[model samples]
Target chain A: MCIVCGCGHAEAGTGEPEHDHGHKHHHSHGSRLDFGGGPAGVSLPGLDQARILRIETDVLAENDLIAAHNRAYLSEHGILALNLVSSPGSGKTTLLVRTIADLKDRFPIAVIEGDQQTSLDTERICATGVPALQINTGKGCHLDAHMIDHALTTLAPGQGSLLLIENVGNLVCPAGFDLGEAHKVVILSVTEGEDKPLKYPNMFAAADLMILTKTDLLPYLRFDADRCIDYARRVNPKIGILRLSSETGHGLAAWYDWIEARRIPVSQQED
Target chain B: MHEMSLTNGILRILEDQARTRNFSRVRTVWLEIGTLSHVDPEAIRFCFESTSKGTIAEEACLVILEPAGQAWCLDCSQSVTVTRRGDPCPICGGFMLHVTGGEELRITELEVE
Candidate 1:
């Protein structure tokens, strides 16, 4: 057995013995298994609990570290981290503009607008007089943690600032990444249809809140609001949804109220 | 099409690996992309070809492993493979499912020369 943990032999690098060298290798899945073992007599099938635990240690441990750093950074700076995810033309920017205007009294707001190229969204956010930082991803489809780190540093958002990170307008690529956001807010427009939650399941699954924007235009569209919620609930039952319109000022109050209430404890957050 | 950025991230990792491990070139990159992760494998491969040029991962063969979405069935207390995300459990057809896997994207391994 590998000396690292009492499991099977460590494959190539770590010194674990390979007892099942030329034996019948049959797994539950009919695939050939190369249990990473060394010269020592180690059998993977009869692995000890310690080695099994070590073997299952995360491969993507870096992301977790970065995410933790991000969380601490956001909390320490008292930045209200909201990661906005959605498909293109999902009205994420429009909602942010209206949200900034609606809740400017309660909290100072800053916007981090990410796009492949173009300062259009930043221009829009700045028109509202809130401090805005435009991050031109320059062909990137999603905003990773490092990008957010750069944006936050550049923007230099002060204490008690609500920072909305309007992530690259792609539904899929941004779902898995954690940008140390207080919450992931996914925008699903009415024109996009209700089945979007089911189709782009991961985004819905990761999101803490679901915003069905463009409700005023729903009269002209065939978006099933109930079905969307049902699908969203199927993927993530805990997701809270707000059906709102940025244009006509519908459901904007509750959206503002929700964020104002879900404030992160500045003292409790790590420095 | 954040594949370009992802390719950049992969290149960054390979460059770090090369510097630390004394490797000059990467022969193969095994990536485990979730079916529900929303990343297009074709787009990543296309970007990888151009992005890998001159990098340590130059000429690396990209292999993608699609892990089936697994959901824990509340009724049966067993995990079932799901073809699509937000679908009912395959074994018991229960609406109450706790997703346990297939919503992650990671560059699993790299074979170097």
Candidate 2:
């Protein structure tokens, strides 16, 4: 009760300064509990010295869940899903066209091309007569599960299909999210520098395999092959490295063999 | 970055939790970003704010905790704490280090009013 107002109670009322609502939650024991603010005058009970996690793990966890769904879906259908990541103009589409041209008769290949705009990459793949769908990311830089889920419906059903999900040309964000690909392939051109792996370690670290594209231009560029492999190994020693050039038809056979090896069903694959 | 989708995920969780508990508003959201996760905290903040727009997590204070990374050293035969994944094992200067932990991104707690 204020001395000026002369009310019946002391320091008590609805939080609103108004006529009584007739009901008040009392400090039954006359003790008030303090929420945590103690760390910076913001400490809560039972959290004073304990390791408190203020994490919203919803994003990555959700992605993992979706990735699991994608993996199971693709595996069940006998689809070999590959997520291709690289810097722009690292010959992703050109390489795909060449690979499809060579292997079109042996396997049913499909391409889900992701780009910020334009259906150019999809058109390139269509030339090979393989089923291809363009995923215009609008302004988005990475491909996620929902996009692939929708693209699978629009494109050939990936069941029993070799699906190549060419992600929007980026070295970063695509490495973080799994688009349900059976394996992640990071393509790098000889001109992109051997230090590219060091600068973007996460990409190299996450990749199941790394392809050094444009190996035909190796003589013209002053790129060191040994140093490039070293950088990638520093980040991820487990990633398989293949050097290839679509123009020279070099390393294409190895690339095909690598893809085939990973696709062998676990039931048949020798442990 | 992919903040909008992350915001959507958070909102979905918040809505689901609120529905079962009869909560109206989320006062705060606690987030953990691992050291090796490579997501920008400032970017997440900006993305969360922009993506939230009238969702359960809208304008909720985003609290971030940086988790320490752990790696298994081939030479040491034991796990060692490190700053980031893919870092050399602190115990043994071996290149064959396997990451054991610290790639955490999660929602551990929430404050509701």
Candidate 3:
């Protein structure tokens, strides 16, 4: 028994009679591979008889559990939560500002802005005459499901309303975490590299839609829209693509249409 | 990096297992990471080594098993091996490949006492 925790074998690494041997052995018999072969020990000293315990589990299980709770809660309340992800300066805030401006009267809209620092994005979102909350992650790269759960309790968006979560401006880390949104929408501006989808295939693969922002600058820049679309499709064949210029109000109608089409009603009927 | 989060998750699992299974310490961790999972094994190792300190899994050894990514080719009607996400089918050389396997990042086993 462990002297420290009183669980097993006197803490495995302390100076016990079990520490006198050079227990290092690597042998495989049949299909089982044995290590040390006596008893499984801790970090040092005795590796003679270590026990192998099979526990097949995902590392993100905890996060995924919380995300599932968020999903069920949102679905029950007839809420449409969209997770917006993009690299820095991809015009997510600008596009959101425009989108909220146009759709605020049509339905109730709330925003949850995530950033490492500063409430500037949340401030911009609130300026549109809509309720918005800012979650500063401090050192976190992306917002997790637990944070979203807290934000939901604090925000308390109306039933059958739209909730937009603008994730920290990152193309990489956010792809791995599921925030229990209806869909993950990745925004890429024309000013950036057209091959971003290929460069960050994980994000493209995880996203349900790819919004090509800053289309008004297409004439001034040499960004190839067709190639960009091809690359995005290469990663995710079913990803919906949209081209919009928030500055010129070019393709906002289609975007708003997409949102309205997916918004779940309080008594939504299933097909 | 998200590897940090993944490592923290591994630690959480280890601690939880220790409590339930009545293990005092963890000696080694066996993880199966897919080639196309976008999780670098080296980065995971580094993150685990750093974060596992002062925890029940402190000084625990990490053993990573990388499985090859496999994709199904719609044009060829065959499954082919892929190393990256956007790689075309090796047999048909077409881009109509859908990933079918090898996106797992799971802990398969543990050595504890």
Candidate 4:
């Protein structure tokens, strides 16, 4: 006898697992439980009335709160945080590696690599001689703002530095979770479908810039670049578009310039 | 998919509410999910059943409310009803429709002790 529905039994378990204390407990999967519905007829008194409380709470409020904190923290510290999202095998990691190697000398750079299992991407990022942190989300599909807040404590991206967060190569889930980044950069390779923007409109709509990656492969593939851009604009008309090839170092300067243009100045922040 | 995580978020909100509202258990949860929110109601229910187990929201009945997607058509200068994200504006048949509503994903009410 459940309090609300009276259809199933209620099992006693720990309510609200402990929060992620810090980076020390990174891999712990909190609140992820696997329990079948218990047998019926577990009743608690005074709960039978089942008063309906008008809560009206947004489900993603917690994530959004932490994201706001992350954004404020980064802005106060003069760090330009960029979240890179794309499907797996979109050459996001390769573009990041190239971007780091090119800009590391000009500015202090840090990378946060997110994946479901191994730290392979983080290893590649660190090989570029830039500080990088690996966040293994385990069974999680996207990285939330709380994880980024914790990673920031360890990575400690210095003032006037660039912090590139490579999200767990996902176009669908990452669009809904804001990690307090200044902007979300979505990458779509030529090898992927040209209608990707139409298929994943949420991701395309949420992004500030759509990077058409692997342009060098365009000669070999039959990817319709114009139609892809058109579809992306259909979802988000103001979204900036850039075509770049990390293998050939083409159009990266313009990408760098775009980043520079969006970077918030330190002096302007004091106001 | 991401519904599992979203369920966890809902559970967290429930737990927090239970502590503050002095409720020991939850019976039903009325969730308002919008058509353009990119969340499937059936998928959320399935994940809710699994994620709610053993918590204050265990065995809770999930009632979902889907609001029709609404967008402001830039070309037509009027609000249009949209069933999906990429659907063209019904009146002007234009793609320059900016979404105005139907993106809500919130727990509107909770039946609790």
Fnat: each model in turn? 0.34, 0.37, 0.63, 0.66
For candidate 1, lDDT tens digit of each residue in B1-113? 66776677777777777787666877766576666666778888899999888877777778776665667788889877776767787777667887776655666445565
Report the alpha-carbon TM-score of model 3 versus the true structure: 0.86
Computed on alpha carbons, the lDDT of every model, listed in order, comes to 0.74, 0.74, 0.84, 0.83
Off by over 4 Å in 2: A1-57, A265-271
Q: What TM-score results for chain B in every one of the models?
A: 0.88, 0.87, 0.96, 0.97
Clashing pairs in 4: A1-A41, A1-A42, A4-B27
B3-88 per-residue lDDT for model 3 (tens digits): 88888889989989999989989988878787788688999999998999899889998878676677889999988888898877
Let me know the TM-score candidate 4 reaches against the reference structure. Answer: 0.85
Residue ranges of candidate 3 with Cα displaced over 4 Å: A1-50, A266-271
* Local distance difference test, candidate 2: 0.74
Report each candidate's C-alpha RMSD, comma-separated, in the order given: 7.0, 11.8, 8.7, 11.9
Return the top candidate by DockQ: 1
Span of 10 residues, lowest total lDDT, candidate 2 chain A: A21-30
Error of 1 at B24 (Å): 2.6
State the displacement of the C-alpha of residue B39, model 1, in Å, after optimal TM-score superposition. 2.9
Task: Say which candidate scores most in TM-score.
Answer: 3
Q: Is candidate 1 or candidate 3 better by lDDT?
A: 3
Give the docking tier of candidate 3.
Answer: acceptable
lDDT of 4 by residue, B2-103 (tens): 999999999999999999989899988878787788688999999999888899988888888676677889999988888877778899777898887778
What TM-score would each prediction reach against the true structure? 0.79, 0.82, 0.86, 0.85
What's the distance in Å from true for residue B76, model 2? 1.7
1 against 4, candidate with superior TM-score: 4
Q: Which regions of candidate 4 are displaced past 4 Å?
A: A1-50, A269-271
iRMSD, all candidates: 6.9, 13.3, 8.7, 8.7
